[model samples]
Target chain A: MRNIEVCFSPELIHLHELQGKIVVVVDIFRATSTMIAALANGIEEISTFSDLEECREMKDQGYLIAGERNGQTVEGFDLGNSPVAFLKKDYSGQKLAMTTTNGTLAISKSSAADEILIGAFPNLSATITYLQKQKKDVLIHCAGWKGRFNLEDSLYAGALVKSLESSHEADEDGALAMKSLFEKEGHQMKAYLSKASHAKRLQNHGIEADIDFCLTLDLYELVGKVENEKVRAI
Target chain B: MRNIEVCFSPELIHLHELQGKIVVVVDIFRATSTMIAALANGIEEISTFSDLEECREMKDQGYLIAGERNGQTVEGFDLGNSPVAFLKKDYSGQKLAMTTTNGTLAISKSSAADEILIGAFPNLSATITYLQKQKKDVLIHCAGWKGRFNLEDSLYAGALVKSLESSHEADEDGALAMKSLFEKEGHQMKAYLSKASHAKRLQNHGIEADIDFCLTLDLYELVGKVENEKVRAI
Candidate 1:
């Protein structure tokens, strides 16, 4: 099997290098979380865009324009990048066209990868289990805070490395390092994230309710893929 | 004081944005650690050169040529970026010209800051105390691995943010994010660090001893500074 590794941040490493690999794009701060929640809540299909203008155009075409700009819900859009919003029963069976600050950028950038799937801490275990059986080279691309490194994303990357330890190879220095972190803290999911940036960001803002919801693992078995300009849950 | 809001790696926040602030260059995967060690060992002064050739030219003038190339001691150099090696007795009163992969690059880039001081996890508390006395914006420029995000460096940034918490202005998103990390596992320094990329690199190479030594807080009072052509401890 081709060895799998992770590039913690998409900006730090290019998607071109990930060609032929099954790339998992992760943005834990609401983007991937929202996608998972929507899919789990029975959203039929979702299209993703990196550019807000494109998403707006899609919105004009009657698609549900759902996304976040600067961490808040967009004024004119049907939805924002909150997992809780996506979890609403009304979102079930509707199509979603979304863009987000970091997550969508990472997903758009991973176009060169053989197959791209949305990754989040909540669905980490299931993602790993699914990928391992396919015998493919995996790249965990952390959609860090707008192309810069953020701890929460890297933590999830480390968590993934830990979960896939038996089947993957962390070929680079950073990847190897993240793997060690996974080995050190994979079992203590809540404890591992208790001190993370996003956790506290949510806490300090009095949005503490989202923290527990974001950390829930294996909440979705559906794998979201980037195909035809949108992330479709399959 | 100008508020120094730093966004950690994989996040796209620029180091230049921290200009006119007291930018503390941090790189624990040896440069900053070696700086503290070099000063503790009585190296009178250090000069940093962004270019390896400049360091080489300084080396010929009876300076103790110290640097690491690809994480190992360069040919004919007196040091190899290891803090333990820097503690040897022979380094006393020596003027050394140093170079390294990521750390020095940041030192070079940060020349425009109001004031620049070197920082590392090893000197966490002392650096904070020193920064607290000054009334300038503080930016912790993590010496990311080869212009990219590395977990260990971000962790150091987090450590600094954690220490200066009472200084609330410095404790914003970047600071708060990192502080939360320290809040969770800061006291368990070694265990907390065992999760980083640098530690694992050393561990994989069987050079785990330095990782332990590099985690010691306030082991030295010396501060590394950018001077003449190099960043040396004074």
Candidate 2:
């Protein structure tokens, strides 16, 4: 059996060896969830940038510049980090240039991995199936809020580990703890995640609808893969 | 109400501002547990060092050198990281110089905090009462295994948060997740921790008794406070 490990935040990513492992970057509050939704809803490709100015400049190249900082859409960007917003309309034949407070930063730091996959509740089963087929060690890198731990991404990690338990042994205590957490709270994810700091932050912004949409599991049957810094549904 | 946050690993310490928070450093599997046991059983003070050589040299200054590396006792140490060993004898008036693979490193890194207190299951109530009296913003620093998240310390964090829930607010998602974990598994902690990687490592060293001893709740009614790098019961 292969091994599964969880790095609770991008800050803890240095403790993990990314090479030869499948790194699943998750920002369940928005970023990765939006990427999966955008790709699954007919967006051609998603290119991630860490700098807001850099991401906004993509509009000049005929790209739909999408980015958010601190949960609000950056001025002049086409969209904010909302998975539900991405599903509102079809963008077939269009490319997305994206950045966010946490998600894109995590993706940028995950370049050394053998493969990078975007993970969130939207593509849970699809990502599981993809990892099972690859048969490599998996590392779930959570895009916690500003280098601190967050609940949504960690709960997603637990969900992945629970589904992959039979095929992958937990490589550390973080994995085991997350697996137990999923087992305890998986059935009531919406209620449990409502207590998360990010959830409250979004609620303060009157975006409770987005939080609910992001927590809906297995909404898409496609997996988001990152190649050469661009994400596409596979 | 004061806020309670958890830093799941020493590596994540930089994400937190420790200058004003009351930092509670925990290594539940042994380090802090043993420190609590030692102080409760009458050891005058415990001085911690991260380097084994630096800790070992304390023997020349009439201090009892107790240290461990990788779950095993280093050569020329008086004791391994065992709470049970400390409880077996009265070490009244004796000073202890100690080092461990994870715990001491966490304590050393927490110097910027308003105060540092050693936390473990054995002194759970004492520490809780102490923190409640202090009424400061609290940060639980888990001395995770090799700068990675560990179940035992994080579980202890959950226990503290749960007990302090009435008077403290969860500051971050890590604290919230840990509170849920402790609520789900606190009653059966011994059985639950049996699955932890550090627990397995200890079992491999034929120290199953140590694990049980470390998990025993409220065995001591004193808190270990670090003042000028020397830990003493206050």
Candidate 3:
């Protein structure tokens, strides 16, 4: 059986071996969810930048620039880190350049993995199906809030690990604990995550709608794959 | 209200500001549990070393040396990382020099904290009472296996967080998640921890009794406090 583990935050990613594993980078609050929405809704490709200015400069390259810092849209960026914003319009063949506080940094750090997949609740089933078919060691990397553990991303990891358990044995305590967490709290996700610091942060920003949308499961049968630093639906 | 946060692994400790917080270092599989047991059973002053040789060298200075690596006792050590061994006899007035794969490294890395307290299920209530009385921000540092997240230490952290919740608001998702975990699994700890990687490792080493002992709650009301690298019951 393939092994599955969870790196609770990008800060803890160094303890993991990424060379031969399928890394599912999850930022459940917005970044990965928005990427999934963007790709599924007709954005051709998504390139993530860790720096706000670098992401802003992408507009000159005809890329739609999306950036967020501390849960707010960066000033002067074309778009913010919201899945609903991506779903509002079809970009058709346009590409996106995005950055966020945690998501983009996690993607940048996971460059060593054999394959990087964006994971969020919207594309949950598709991710599970793809990983079940891939049959490789899996590392679910939660893009936790600023290198600290977060509830939503880890719940998604737990959900994914629970779904993949038939074929993949959890190899670390993080995975096991998360799997149990999902089992205990998966039924009332929105209510459960309402206590989450990130959720409360977003609520304070008056984006409760985005939080509800991001937590919605299996909205699209889309799998966002990272290739050469750009994520496109596969 | 005082805030409670959990650093899931020692590797992620740098992301946390330790200066003003009470750092509760926990290695529930054995290390901290053994320290609590030793202190409760009449051992005086435990000094921890991260290096096996350094801990072994303490024997020349009349310290009862204990060492563990990957859940097994070092060949030349006076004792392994088992709380049961400490309870077998009273080494009254004797000092202990100990090293373990995860616990010692966690203590060594947590030197910047205003106060370092050893936490385990055995001293769960004492640690909570002390933190409640101190009225300071608390950081529960789990000495995970080899700088990775582990189940047992995190569960103990959750128990502490849950007990302190009336006076402490959880400041991070790790604290929130673990509090929930302990609430869900605390009643069935032995059966729950059987699925943990380190527990399986210790079971493989024929130390199932230590696992049971470590999971025992409130066996002692001793709070092991670190001052200048020496831990004494206070």
Candidate 4:
């Protein structure tokens, strides 16, 4: 039977061990959400970078830049970290060079995985369907707040575990715990997330709409997979 | 307001910042349980060490030695990682020098805190009472499975957070997520932990009773506090 595990934060990841596993990086509120939104809105692909300067350098190469630090838009960037910012944007053939505090860093660190997929509430069902079809061991990599576990990401991981529980066995305590949280509180994602630090941080920045948008389930039918340093629809 | 945060694993701890905070190190499977049991059984104090050699050396200095690695008792140790082993044993006025795979390591790493308290289900109410009286910020440091997040510790942390929720606020995502898990599964700890990897590991070793003992709430009325490298009742 395929097993499911959760890496609560990117810092706990052992890259070499992920070599043959399927990894789903969840960065709710809002990196993964933004990525899903950008993809659903017709952005062709997104190249993720850990450094803002690296993403900035891509601007000259026809990549639109989206960078954020501490929940604020990075200086001189085309977009902030809010998913709502990506709504209705037309980029059918354009590439996005994006950097965020946690999500991008997680993607960059998960290069050893056989396949890396972006996961968020907006494309949750699609992501689950994609994983269920793969039939490989799944590792939900939560892009926690700066190397610490965060509620929003874990909640998304819990939701994923809940979806996969019937067919997959939780491989560790982290996975079991996450699934339990989802079972208890998955019905009220937005209300539960309102108590999260990141949600409050974003709320302070007047992005409540983005929070609501990101928490919406199945907004997109596409799966975002990291390939050649870019996240593209698969 | 008193703020509660949980370091889901020892690896996520930022030692320098933990200074001046009230930190509770939890290793529910055995170490903290053992410590609480030893104290309740009249052991004078427990000196915790991350290095096995340090614990072994203390044996020569008249300290009762206990050591565990990978869930197994180390060779030449006086006791294994079983709290039941310490139960009912008369260790009056004798000090214990101990090392464990996760618990002792977490305690050693949290020495920078203003006050370091050992937490386990056995001493749950006592620890909670102590924390409530202290009326300071709390950080539940879970001794995860070798620097990785684990379920049992997080569940214990969640229980702590839940008990203190009326007066304390969860300061971060990890704490809130843990509390959520605790709220969901706290009532069925033994049944829930039976599914945990560590519990299975211990059961495989024919120590199922230890799992039961560790899950027993409020078995001891002592709060084990770390001071000068020793954990003693306060």
Candidate 5:
């Protein structure tokens, strides 16, 4: 049994440490979820570029380009970070290249990992089972709300830890804190997260519908894996 | 029945929001605990500053200037953030002007609070009692380790929340999570907290001695509060 160690923020992680490890990148806010949705709907593959200019080049290459800046779809991109918006597309056999403010950055940084996959609540169970089978020491990277720790990401990390059972080892206080959060609160995420500052901000921005949609679980059948800087659906 | 809020990060607060309320600024690492020790040992008053340059200037003004960077004493100051250091000088009828990376920023930002107070585990009960008597909304600002969530601050917030009993309402999920943490794990803060990420970091930095000092309970008789951009013992 390989050790399963989860990191709550990307800032705290040293990329060299995760080398040759099976890493799962979780940005539950909307990016990972949107990516999963885009792939699940049969988008050929997603070229996740950290550079907006590269994403634009891919868009110009006749691909369905989806990108988000500050949680909204970039002015010219075909979609935004909202998981719901991607579901509106007919991605059958089409390739998608996307960029996001936080999630893509996290995925890009984990390029040295042995394997990198996307995770969200919708695919949480599947992700866990697969990781357990791979049985490599797993590190769950929480894309914190802009270099700051947020309850939503930590809570999700906690839930993953809880579901993984004895395979998990919390080497840091954040891991223990999330474990405590899960042990006490036990995963009523939507209700618990409704009051989050970001959720509140998003609600105030008229994306209230997306918040509800984002909270829904098991909506996508896509499992995204990072291959050569792009997450292609397996 | 005053409102009690939990600030998970220092970024969420501005100086203006704390005006005229009993704001509890917590830096469980060592600063707040040192304040509790100095005041409890019959120190007259305490002044908090965010700038080390200002602290240097205060030394020339005949005030004791003590602080730390990277958990060690500043090269020229009278003392560092260690509670052990504060116990050396009898502060009766004297003033302390201090600066630190985390706690001092919390003090500066909360200068507008009707009364801003330092909260640490050593004086946990007394701090809660003082806030209870004041009978107004209490905001627990955790001076997270370098501007992010730390277990010690959240635990103290949980301790205060658990102390409020029927008199307080759970204001937000951060508080609720804290309350839950306190309920389940408050009884063993040291065993749990001494193992915290920051605590371990301190231990690695050779300041593990300070950790033991910070976790002590009810060790001080003085309450430290802030006014005019300074923390003065009241």
Candidate 6:
């Protein structure tokens, strides 16, 4: 039986046994959603960097830069951290350098994993289909808000676990708790998530549309995989 | 309105802004349950120590010692960690020195709080009454298994939040997730907890009855307050 565990926040990245596991890095509020949208909108490949200077350096090398820190777009970047910004944009053979407060940091820390998949509501079904094919122990790593647990990522993690067809055991209390929360609130996700701290934080910044778009399920059929410090459509 | 938060594990203690908050330390599997039982059975005060050597020194000073590491009773200690061990004991004016792998360590780390209260299912009603009287922002600090999240303590934290009748808001996602878990599974707590990892660990040691006793609600009418390294009925 494949064991499924959900790491509720980036703070728990160190506690997880990531080696040999199929890690699904989730930042449903924006990062992973933007990647999914970018890939679907024809961005060739997205290079993820944890450092702003590294992303900037890649931007200087003729790559489109997209990132955010504390919910604000990085200065001089070509695009902000909104999935809507990537929509309808065409860059068939170009590269996009990306960074974010939580998602990329989670990806960098999870480099020990055998495989890494980017997960968000927009790519939910595709991610689940991919995981069902792999049949490995799944670890949903939620990129919470700045080292603290956030609702949206965990809710998406729970949604992923709930959609899996295989029999699995929760590795810890966090996993069980997330599954229960997902089971309880899954049907009312949009309404429930409106009360989430990060959602409120983003809404306060006049970005409520981003929250609605991120919560939309299966907007892309592409599954993002990490290769050579970048996320490419697999 | 008071803001209530539940730190699901010691990993989250630092993430929370615990200053000036009334922190309720919960270790429902045994430690806090034993403290409630000890105080209910007439022990004057229990001095909590995080160090094994400190607990040993107090034992030499004629205080009855009780502690466990890796779920086993400490060698040369007067009692094991089972709450039932404290029952029917008479030490009306005597002190007990205590330590445990998770519980005391959580208490030691949460010294920055405005006030600290020892919480367990056995003292559920009393704890609720005490918190209701205080009217401060509450932070339920769960002493999870060795710094990782565990089920029982989080469940008890949920129960505490569920019991409070005051107008309160969850400070973060962890608190809201826990409260939802409690609301969904509160009625079937014993059966639900039987599947917890710590429950299996304790059951392997042939202490399943301890689990039942620990899950018992309101067996004691005492609320424990920590002062000068000791827990006293308050």
Instruction: Give one digit per residue, the lDDT tens place, for model 3 in B15-47.
Output: 899998899999887888889999999998999
Q: Lowest summed-lDDT stretch of 10 residues in model 3 chain A?
A: A193-202
Tell me the TM-score of chain B in each candidate: 0.87, 0.96, 0.96, 0.94, 0.90, 0.94
Interface RMSD of each: 5.9, 1.6, 1.6, 2.1, 4.6, 2.0
Native contact fraction, candidates in order: 0.18, 0.78, 0.73, 0.75, 0.38, 0.48
**Tens-place lDDT digits, model 3, residues A38-121:** 998899899988878888999999999997776678888888888898878788999999887688889988999999999999
Query: Which runs of model 4 end up more than 4 angstroms from their true locations?
Result: A69-72, B69-75
Best-to-worst ranking by DockQ: 2, 3, 4, 6, 5, 1
| Cα distance off (Å), candidate 2, residue A207 | 1.7
Best by DockQ: 2
lDDT of 6 by residue, A30-73 (tens): 88988888898888889887788888899778899987766678
DockQ of 1: 0.21
Error of 4 at B113 (Å): 0.8
Candidate 1 chain B — worst ten consecutive residues by lDDT sum?
B7-16
State the lDDT of candidate 1 residue by residue for B85-203, as single tens digits: 87657567688888776676777767677788888766677777778888777887877766655556666776777566666354344464455445555567677556554566668
User: Scored by CA lDDT, what does every candidate get?
Assistant: 0.70, 0.88, 0.88, 0.84, 0.73, 0.82
The two-chain DockQ for each candidate, comma-separated, is 0.21, 0.72, 0.70, 0.67, 0.27, 0.59
Q: Give the TM-score of candidate 3.
A: 0.96
Each model's Cα RMSD: 4.7, 1.6, 1.7, 1.8, 5.2, 1.7
Alpha-carbon error at B23 in model 4, in Å?
0.4
Q: What is the lDDT, from 0 to 100, of the residue B51 in candidate 2?
A: 84
Tens digit of per-residue lDDT, candidate 5, span B182-227: 8988888778876565677778878766787787777655577766
Candidate 6, residue A200: how far the Cα is off, in Å? 1.5
TM-score of each predicted structure versus truth? 0.77, 0.96, 0.96, 0.96, 0.74, 0.95
Between 1 and 2, whose TM-score is larger? Answer: 2
